[model samples]
Target chain A: MWRKVLTFGVLVVFAASFLLAAPVTIHFWHAMNGPLGAMVQKLVSEFNQTHTNIVVKADYAGSYSETLSKTIAAVKGGNPPDLVQIYDIGTQMMIDSGVIVPIQKFIDQDKTFDVNTLIPQVRGYYTVGGKLYSMPFNSSNPVIYYNKTLFEKAGLNPNDPPTTWEGFKEVAKKLTVKNADGKTVQYGFTSGLVGWFFEQYMAVQNALMFNNENGRAGRATKSAFDSPAGLRVFNFWNDMVQSGVMINGGPGWDNANGIFASQKAAMLLDSTSDVGMMLRQAKEGHFELGVMALPHPAGVPYGGVIIGGASIWMINTHNTMKEKAAWEFLKWLEQTEQQVQWSEGTGYFPINKNSLTKMMYQGFYAKHPQYLTTVFQLLMSNVTPATRGGLTGVFPKVRATIEQALSKTFDHAMTPAQALKWAQDQADSAIAEYNSLY
Target chain B: MPRKYVPYVLLIPTFVIIGLFIYYPAVMTFQKALYKISPFGNRSFFVGLRNFENLFNSPSYSQEAFTTLIFVVASIAIGLTISLLFSLLLNEKVPGVGIFRTIVFSPYAVSPAIAGTLWSFLLNPVVGYVSYTLLRIFGIHSEWLTSYPLALIAVMVATIWQNLGFNIIFFLSGLQGIPNSYYEAAKIDGAGAVTRFFKITLPLLSPITFYLAIMDVVFTMFTSFGIIDIMTQGGPGNTTTTLIYRLYRDGFIYFNSGMASAESIVLILVMAVITFIYFKFVQRTVHYR
Candidate 1:
């Protein structure tokens, strides 16, 4: 009887040990902050709750640029997180880093996951040589956010926003309000000195910013933005600034948004990711907001705005268990439900094509028509190489060069042609230097 | 250990720290300046000073260097002058002098970035209180940050304001350390305030002034990154892009670590020359007593 009792106790102890085994932990570094960060935490906790065998640790790693730098430093220090979120412009650089395991590898191995389900424009930006390196998380494009009340006050139709650059200028001129003292009290349009907008304008004109089909066909050897298409965009922008229809909103997104929110500017060109915040700001400002697609230059076939924002990249740790666990979390994040949740929580539209078909999103779109405007813009965009966005390791530097060109043009220190030429030269040299090293 | 070795043994920790943190990084940066390094530092090849050559050939580098010189000289000259004036005034035996002293020194307690943020808000074109007041009263739309010379001036003004407290603290202490007997003797000699200031006070405070000048030069060169970044982001067509700001752009934003390292080496050399000149020529004017 004593021997039987000992065997029973040993069996119970063995069962307890097996039941209490440690779960695999996945480290995730992201750039999301504020309400979006809270949503990320909520999703992580929910995932942790349902998946008893896996625990995901999420960390807010500052801004997109900071996160990329921190991730690279961590990788060099031999303690990188399993996954990291990097901005759209960092795609080529991250790909060239040779540190990330392409998400396509897991997609190919996982028979249940469908790669084609992602929105083409969103997926195309992250795809290199027909393979997606990262999972599209937050995708956005430039959109015109106008104050409808201001439009009406300016004797313009609130529903019919301009679709062409010339028409945009004409409307902007009309919207500009001046006092009896010859002081302009309200400017018509304002945008930050952001190079992303320049790139979008180029895209809308079906213009390649760099050679080799915007670097998608191959590595871009030189900047192609000094062409007529580039000059047209620059000339239009310069004319607006020169004519005093638009105000220089300075160098950051917040400044332009402030100009609009304070009723100092009638329209603002900004990322669609700001839709939720813009809506709230409009409500606070007691003005009705209207959203529209970015205007294209006249007599040009509209290409479309390139996909902006960031994607989640899986770091190569050479540990299959950690890799698989991270991939599982990524796949879970791409689910229609989670996509809908993310879209509603943040202004970034869902990249999963199936999410649009869901009844939940249908109802959500019906209630908030402004959100559908960005979705329609994305759907209408042509999936050409120009719209696929430029792929170069020196994209950030190229963008800075473009911004400098814009600044020179705006300051009237250089004409549009001269500024673009300067930018082209600087960008080409930067690209050459980066290509040589990479 | 021998008796001589005892001191060396005690100094080991300091040597180790300095070697690890300062000398090691300096050596690494010098080595990196000769190579073309990938952004992640995974791959590199010796380029042998090509980065420095490229920088020298670039127009932007010269422009930035010029801007850096103007910023350093202007900030130091104007900053020191205003700080000396405020310190002298606060040095008077007036009522509420302690409060004035605290107010003058308060900005020194604030970080450069915080000072920059505060100043940016005050100087913002559309909604800034200063701009709004100017528009309302004078009808002048001063685009403080987006315009050319104004952008540089705005950055300088903010930097000077932020650094004023530091200079004031030093000048105030230096003033306090001045023996009252010297001023009494000057008064007896029938020396006017200005004459006394130029002759006695200025020369006697030369040591502190010289020290402050060197510190201010270094501060304006290296520590003005925050103010420039916040106010203008070295913008309006590179009108305000200083060498330090350029270095940050290359190293952090653009990920041109090799070029950044090269720029850093150049910066170190520039500072060394400046300090050398200060000690060689300016030190002779400094009076200890």
Candidate 2:
């Protein structure tokens, strides 16, 4: 009698456990770190708790560069994860790889999901030829962050920052301070010399960076950065450097951020995502911080800040059930509450339109006015062909080429036109290589 | 299995590992050089010698070749000279010989990437203490990483510093094997230290010097990837990009496998010819006891 009862209990326990075991687990690789990574973990855990039928495992890949490189290796190795977060610059390459499923297909098969709810400018970056390729996640724009205390010390208005390039130069000249030995103790302005600034400044002037309407109508065959507007931007920057008001800060973002945080520079041009970081650094250093949109020429009417950040893409090289589970997780991620939580936690502008209406978000933004500047900048953007962003399969490489050009002109005494002409040639060749392959 | 085949059987594991990790990829690299491959390794097409032709005809080829030549030759020369100096001093009858040997050989334990990062931080104009002192004392603002020539020089310094310890050890061991009777005889014959070093010690150390020279050249040519990657990344206008770095950039960063493979083939041919020349020239001059 004892033996029979024990066998029955064991069989029942095994059967119940087998029946309750979760279905396929979705592996997601992303590049979020620090507070943003923690927020992503929280969201994934919440989804796991709500959906008892499936489990989602989130892994933090290093940076966008590392993540994309690893994802390419994973795809070629035939062991791809269910989802990956790729930067917007990688959209063309992602599509060319043919490793991802169009999120539109999932939206088409599902009746509840709506693609129209996405913010237009944010959505436009990930779309190609009338098809949405990836889900927009973190999006930001370049903004001018200034030391409020320094502005007051320089006798400029603390509340009003320059919105035009010429006016900005004038204010920057006033803000620049030098020691008795004629060595500059504080530069008037410093900007990150990465390729994104060129892209953003071009968008602010309403100029296209690549041919074929910024490559939305068709594939880009060449880069258009050596045009008249580009020449103007380069010449303006060259004059700033020559005048001893602006520091090049080299080509890395960390160097520029260091220059700004250490109070060696009165003003800095950087990403909107860094608003929270900049404020935190200022608080630690006891400096007042202010924010404004990036400056272009006088006539463009704040033409616009272009979107900059990574987006999430679903790789469908797995089984059908896994893809379904991944799609469900993505849908849950796109919820209004989740979007607000992400934006508030990470200072990335909200990708969802309805998320702006939430009382919690409003309260948070009221407390942090610096973050609101990004929202207004995005709202006021004109969404021109230039602002939609340059789409080429070799954008990452092209950006490297352009940054090299910036270095040559900024540090090596090369003329702006000469550096830009060399960049144009290199970019054209790179684009040709990419186009031939695809 | 025959009894005579047992030794062959014992060697099978090593052979398999070498074949799998070394020979197989080498063969595949040669094969892949003839084709244009997609990102996913699907839809490959043969393009013959076009990849090679394009690489040679490209405008950046001359700069890359010159940079590689300068980096390899300069690093090998610097490594051998410094290591030889240190080894000679350490091989003396000085006190704390063991500690001095350890001190001289300690840097070899550091990985190339760490060394590169350390030197980069130390050489940074804004934050580096070395640069700060130089500016304060002498008013010399050396752009260690910004200017193309200075950046290549920085990379070479880092590479030579990291490789010096290994060469020192080889030269030290070579010094230990030499009989002391000849040195005493030279001293008795009224030969000065410099004359004794050149006539007696150098000839005795020829075999070791030959070995180290060939190895230093090969290591600088092929194994300086990590230093180049961290310090300069072949930049300021491709001034620090060596041939190996170029191969990796084209293959991985640009996703052009055919050209990378063609570059790899060229690298192999260059290395093979270098080794042939090195052996033909240096082996004849080496004197064994």
Candidate 3:
């Protein structure tokens, strides 16, 4: 009887070990914070619950730049997370790093997964040399979010927003409000001194930012945006600031949003990712918000917008089990249902093409029409190399130079031509240096 | 273990820690300054002083150096003067002195980033409380964080505010250490308050002042990154981009580690020279006894 009992106990222990199968734990570092972070957590927990043999430990890894820096350090220290969310500008740097395994490898190996299900424009940005390096996660494009209430008060049609540079200026002048003292109480437009917006403006004018087909065909050795298209953008921005119809929202996203939310400014130029937050802000501020496509220069065909936001990349951890688990999580995130959920949760539009046809998305769009505007704007965009955006390891440096030029131009310290020229020179040198190194 | 080597044995952990964390990194930084490292540091080649040459020749480096000079000098001069005054005031025997001292020293408890955030909201051009009040009362609207000079001034203001408590604490201690008998003796000798302050107080406080000046220089040079980052991000045409902030941008953001390493070396040299100048020239005026 004692022998039988001991054998039973050993059998029970073996059954428990086999049934449990110690789930593979994969670390994921993301830059999403606030509401977006919550959604990521929710999705991660859902994935964990569904996949019995896998557990994803998600970490909020500061901002995009911080996340990239931390990931690089971790990779060098030989303990990088299995997956990391990198911003759009970091794509070239990641590709040059040569530390990541292209997600295309997994896509090709998995028989059930279809790469075509991903949105073309979204996927195009992450694709280099005919191979997708990362999975397109939270993709966005810039749009004009205007105060409809302010527009109506200014005697303009609330339904129709500006579509051209000239029109935007005219609208800005009309929307600006001032008292008898001539001190302006409200400005017509404001935007953060973000470099992404300048890139989008260049794209909408069908202009490449860097040489060698916007750095897609080959390594970029020089900046290409100092041309007429670039000047047009700079001149327009300068005109607004000089006319006193626009407020310098400083730099970064929050201040500009503050200016808009406080009703000090009537319109804001920001990423489409702010749709969810902007809608809530409008409600709290007792104003109606209007969304429109980014304006192009008059008489120039719209080239569309480059995708902003970030994508998730799988690092080469040399552990096949962990790699497989990370790929499974990525595939699950791109499903139509999950994409719809992510889109509804965050203002970032869905990257999965089939998410648009889903009933959930249709309902979401019906409730929040602003989201549809962003989606349609992306869909209508021309699939040009310019729209696909520039690629360079020195994008952050180039962006900084452009922002400085913008600041100089706006403050009348330099003419738009001179500022763009200086920016072009600085960008060229940075790119040249990066190319020489890598 | 011999008795003579006991102290050395006891210090082994400290030496090992410093060697691993501090000395090793410093040596690595010096070595890296001579090499052109790739973004992820996977590829590197010896460039041999080219990074330093490139930095010196760069247009922005001179501007950054100028900005750094202004930031350090102004922060030290202005911050020390104000802190000295506050410390002197709080040194007096008065009701609620403890509470006042605590209130005056509260800012030191706030982290630089939090202090910067607070100041950012206060100075924001559109909806900031300070800006709104200024506009409402005087109709003067200044872009505090976006304009060139104003952005630097804003960062300096936040930094000084955050560091005031620390400066005050040191000054207060120095002030307390001064004997009241000195002031009484000066009064008996027909010395006026101003004369007494200059003749006795100033001379006696020189040592602390000298130490503070050096500390303030190092603090402004190295630790103002958080304030500048949160405030202007070295923007408005890089008006606020000091050497340290520029180092961070080059290394972490631009991934030009070689240039960053060179900048770090220059920073170390700058610090060393300043310290030498203090000990050689400025130390003559300090009255330790």
Candidate 4:
């Protein structure tokens, strides 16, 4: 018994020593929870299976905000993860924080890396002062999701969905059902109301949401949401709520999606990224659904919606070899085949234009033509600096103000003018405050 | 045991841990606060007191500081009061006490992220069960998280609900530890329930109360990060942006490490000072055996 125990103890020590000598582990922190979280783990497993020298450990770090906080804390503590997926709005902040080495330089160093073929809009957001800082991992935008059954139930043609705001309003009013006491039984339209959605909405309307090339040019520009077109959009949204044509979908995107999925609301404006999950839920509920471009205001420019999604930055928290490994991973991620697989699996628009030509994407589109809108939105986007996206040093703060403004407008707590004025004032102050730091 | 060196041996592990985890970071944060670092890991020349000066001059910091204070104070005060009241009621021979206890303590066991996610879903303006019930019952419809003035209140409500259970458990333990002889003595002296509670119960639970208050204050300030981060994100016009969240944003979001480090040092100092003040001023008011 003593000899057997000694043998086991010796084996355990040998295993421990082997593990200690294993290749350097690169930690990746992310906020992809639920199904996507599992999918990410699978991706890491596949990566580990292929790569023998590098072991990538995936840590689930709650929501996007939580993940950001954790990454920052780690960076501050001088023990940051080798890789982290940061949301687009935080790109500027992350770029300014010198810890991240631009992956473009590394890609440039690698003769095989063909980053030039990257989807322009995807790469555009991460490029700071004409240099790319991060790689676009997930690119999504708000799209109009409608319940075909609800459209039919309201005696409207299921195939014909609204494309313009006026048309949307008329259809929404018609589709809204009232109970015996005149209370709403089924709402016509709802959306995840926040600045990001409004920003996309404004982009669709060809309105200048902010100045300084919408933060792509430089950080000195102030927000231009107080423009005439901006006021009109806010007023239009307010009117929809006041007329009971729309309901407060929820404070954010997920809530809005829930209301529509539950059939409590007929139409939803949510991220195209949620398409896969929504489709699964719809299949389970046995509800037929339709997808359409987000409704644009009448007579607006044909400038398409802004790209909204997350990207991965190569943080300089590692040594040269680790940096090279990260670049290799990023390059692999951007490859047409990989992009096609990722986009098809996640319902996010591929960040590589070449990926769209892949048979996998074509096959998916052939099965569900609805999948084409994700690519169409990208192609139709106005290539001008302003229409590309909104930028500001304090976009996170500005987003909060817009949410507050919209909340009050929707809740009947204040008028559109009042809310806009407050938001404008708040945003102006935030911009000024953020500018002072430099 | 080796009696001569026993104390030193025992003290070594604790001192090493405290040094590595707490003291070392505190000292490094103070050092980094003086130097401005760029996004490329480029170190800037030391700008003595400039980050603090910038913090004071900025309206965002002012707003964040005030919000943090309000959030910490309100959450702790309201959470403790509700728990205390519930504990008093729970002390009685109530039906299904164990079930009630479990229900109250359930939120405590939940991770803060889960708690935030669940409560955010519950408090959503539309399709949220809580919101639907509240509106139907009271004819009140408000965006709990998005409304500017009330956003803080909404955050506090979610925070208190998730925390009240844990506080109740603490208070319950404290209440049970109070000997029955004291209550029996109070009854003999013709003390009514209110007097007994105010004079005897409250006073006797003072030590636990002190500890809970300190722990709650520190925990609420430093840790609520998850709840606020997930729920409000210091949003709806920075109404819920606490000091920690702002520190996070400035440091991580913008990569303003110098500012973040400066803010961290300030945060630590504020926490230490407040704790010292509480122990000195408030701790004195409490009675303990």
Candidate 5:
């Protein structure tokens, strides 16, 4: 009996060792939580199915910040993952680190790997100094999400959505309902504290937010948005917050979506990627939903939202085989068919221009024409560096500065000018501190 | 020699683990502090105290440092006092005291993230029943996180509530260990309840109090980032950007590993000095039996 047990144990150990050596598992860390996480798992399963040599093990790594932290820790520990999904804000830092194997380099090695077919705006974001470091995976932009039910209930035309800033305010004023006790029953609008969205608003007005090629060419030398025009936008937002027409809830994108889904708020400014979740929730609650271009100051057609989403990058800290495998996966992801599939699964815009015209995408666009608006917006966007996503090593910290300043203003601790000045000063100091290191 | 070596052998595992996991990383972290290191690739360049120089000059660091102090001081002081008071009350033979003790200590079992989420819901403007009730009753509809004074208060409240249970359990155990003979003697001396507490109970409990104080201070300072991350995310415009939170932002968000390393070293030094000062001065006042 003892001899038989010993033989079984040996076999088990040998089997485990063989399995461990079967194929190197590529660790793919991402911040796709909830339904998006499930979708990512399915995609990985498909990848593993098609490519038996490289087993892609996709793991959820909390939010964007947490994933970045874990990746950095793993890198320090000499156990970095093969692939990582990093937000656009972290591009400069990742590029400066020189640890990421530029996808451009990898693609160049493989002639079949072509990136020229992708949309210029999408490719341009990942491309630094004309070399793409990553493949755009889940690109999104902010758009106006409104509750059509609320618009109709307020005796306004639901079809004609707010087109301009002033129009947005007038519609919001009508939609905002007060109770018998004079308490606001329904808020007309809610926008979270996001500098990017505000930047988009300014962009529509053909205004500059920063200098030194908007930190695209190099490190930002100065921030130029501290102008009277910029202050006017903030002032208008502040007035809305004070008037109870809009709420200044800090990064309440989820909250605003919930409110809009439940017909509590008339409109919400949020990311396009959230359409899947919002649509599902709206369907469940039977709420009438509508979409429009984010309100710019009426006459400004130049206001285009910069992309906001994660892009997959191959970390070079891994072994050679793992790097090659990661490169293969990224190339596969860039394919038009795969891009279309991914966009269909999530509400994210397809990076490949061809994917936009794919038959399946055509059917989706036919049913939801508003979903196709993002593609048009990107196409029409001014190719100026300012209209491109803002670049800074500490962009997340800069966003927090906006959050902090807006929150203070919302709490009435400081006026719009005071908050803006403080935020700019704080952001400038943070930028300078970050620049000193590099 | 063998007998002496037996004791050394017992200590070896702990020392090895600490040296490898804690001390080694700490040393490397200190070294990394003196350079410009990014996570992706090129080895950091030696910048010679430049990161520290820049940190002190930055408003974010200064503000975060100050806010960290506020968070640590407020959380520890308030948490200790309320927990101590609750411990004393639960120590008494009151009605359903056992159940009360269990309930008070229950929140300690919850993760800080869970606590933050629950508190956020409870304090949310539109949906939070607690805040809604408070507004209706008081005629004040202030944003708890928006109001700067109230924002820290909200953080402190969550920190205190989440941590009170752990401190209560500690104080309760300490209270139970107290000799009944001391109380009997006080009773014989016709000492009032308050007098007996101050004279007999307070002096004797000083050792546990000192331990709890040190533990609480360290725990509060180190772990405040979790609550801040979850509850406020150092928001309302950097009102709650604690030291550790800023460390997280600098390291992870900005990907400035060098500066993060420097900030961490500064944090370690600050914690070490504070601990040393406590042992030097406050420990003398402990009056352990």
Candidate 6:
């Protein structure tokens, strides 16, 4: 009887070991939706098929903000996934959460990988204390998407779009048309007045969005939206909205997309990721779409824009093999081939320069000259600490306040200076409160 | 098992479930409100009452409080009056009464999130049918989701529309529950329609009115979260922000857990006091057999 029991126990142990030795399945939670989601799934499946010893399962985790909140909750509940994709604004908070397996660790462990190959501005947003916290998976900057048909009708050059806000306003005023009934047939400018868009405006001036070197030298103690640059942004939006140049289409990405898609607006200031969608839609419409860098304030050197999309984060699950497997996935995702494929598929900037050398991408750019505009703009913008975007514990809230301030200006409830000052105070208190908690 | 033990055993599962989900979370909220906790759930230190103090001292707190009060009051006043009017109409023997009642009650079936999205499309200032028609004809669409008081009014309109169904059902039942003979007695006594409505119908329906009042206040506090999230996002300078939205923003969005917990406690206190006032004074005059 004892020998039989021993044989059964041995069999059970061998079975458990065999099960554990099988391919390791790692869960990746992301926020890719729509066509971009299909692209991600394709890449994920391709990776899974090629790698026989490992399997990566990707979960669509809603929008960027939703994914962050879910990831945080899962951490507290002790069931976090192996990896997540966090947006740029959540960098400081992600680092402070202390739940990340710094990409630097993986790079150091694998001597063949070099972190410096990452685009400068892309790297700047994820670096903390000289170490990259997350891998820059996808990056996109703001661009001016113009309706060339409307531009030609308005007697403006489609190729030479506005480079400054003043120029844009003039162009918008010219392009705005009314029917015989005195109704607005086409507004010159309309965009979702979101907090993220506000960040692009500040970044183009090469201005620090927050004090303390955009919170890279130390923690951000105050918001810099009350400065001259911020006031200018507010006044531009306010004046445009109050006049008929820019229509209040309401706030959010969907409304902005709607206004542009319906051809009610001549120009749209939105992200580069929107290029693919806009181009596809334009092909079916009567207009030719053109892309340009985000406009700057007149006379000030174009300080340029920062990357504003999501990045890949390796969640620290405290198991060495799992961490190593996640890193392998990350390295695979960062390959030049994958980067070029991602850029071509999603209109996101290729993080690795080697991807630009790919003949297929060059062919893609030649076929669609509009696609080259964002790449040229990104290369022209000098990477600086200020243009890299701010890192703060309450960046998302600070942005909400900025949106509130901007909204107040457009609503005629408060002047630009007053609203910005109020926003500065609100941001200060929020940061102070956040610092106290951490 | 013995019969006495069976009752306890059956109830044990419910009590355990409630204890884990409800009582445990509530106690943790109260305890966490007194301490400073980071986003990662680390207990840095305790500062009792300071969370509450800081909340009141903060610049946006008063505005937030006023905003929440205005939202609740506006939603209740508008929702209650419209609901009562609809209920009165629904109670009458008008033609197609069933269809009218069904139409009034259908919004209750729509989730807040879906309703919010629908309203967002309807009120979109540029391409929306409502806004486009008004703008093309009148040269102004009020920028329903962009302008200040207009945005608040827009959200309130959605809130009232959502609660109107629940309010109508309750008031309809309340109207039905009253003995028809009372109305007949008033009619025989030469009481006019307005007088009978004021004197007999209003007084007899006090209990239902009271119940709806409490439910509306609670709904304004909690359920409007979805509409606010989808439609306005508490924007146009915090005109649409309420206590619950503030709690969500401070705690989850900003990661100020201590402040969020304190605000949660204050919201509970406010709801409790409102309830207390309703029960102590308002319920006394309610008619019951």
The candidate that achieves the highest DockQ relative to the unseen native structure = 3
lDDT of each: 0.90, 0.83, 0.91, 0.78, 0.78, 0.85
Error of 4 at B73 (Å): 5.2
Question: If scored against the real structure, what TM-score would every candidate get?
Answer: 0.95, 0.90, 0.96, 0.82, 0.89, 0.94
Q: Across residues B198-258, which tens digit of lDDT does each residue of candidate 6 receive?
A: 9988888888888888889899889998899888988877888888988988777777787
Model 1, B72-149: lDDT tens digits are 999999999999999999999999999999998898888888887887778767777888899999999888888899
Give the chain B TM-score for each candidate. Answer: 0.96, 0.94, 0.96, 0.91, 0.91, 0.93
Pairs of colliding residues, candidate 5: A97-B41, A99-B40, A99-B41, A204-A303, A404-B237
Task: List candidate 6 segments past 4 Å from native.
Answer: A1-13, A179-183, A283-285, A359-362, A436-438, B92-96, B179-192, B278-285
Q: Can you write out model 2's per-residue Cα lDDT over A249-321, one digit (the tens) per residue?
A: 6545765677788787899989999888999999998999999888889865555778999888999775788
Give the per-residue lDDT digits (tens) of candidate 4, residues A281-304: 789878987888888888876667
Shift of residue B99 alpha carbon in model 1, Å = 2.8
By lDDT, the best candidate is 3
Interface RMSD of each: 1.2, 2.4, 1.0, 4.4, 2.6, 1.9
For residues A1-438, what per-residue lDDT tens digits would candidate 5 score against the true structure? Answer: 999999999999999998867876789999998878888888888888999888998899988878877877787678888899988788877776556788887767888866788888777777777788888899988888888777888899989987778998999999888776777767898766676677777666656666676777767856666777578777878888888898655554554555566666778888889777777776887777777777677654554567789898788864787888888787777777777777878888888767888834469887876677656677777666756667777677777677777777777889989988987887787777667656
Two-chain DockQ for model 2 = 0.35
Q: State what share of the real interface contacts each candidate retains.
A: 0.63, 0.26, 0.78, 0.26, 0.53, 0.66
lDDT of 5 by residue, B126-237 (tens): 5466666876776556667555777788888988898899888888888888899988988998999999888977777777777878887777777767777776777877
Distance from true location, Cα of A280 in model 6, Å: 3.7
Candidate 6 chain A, which ten residues in sequence have the lowest lDDT sum?
A353-362
TM-score of 4: 0.82
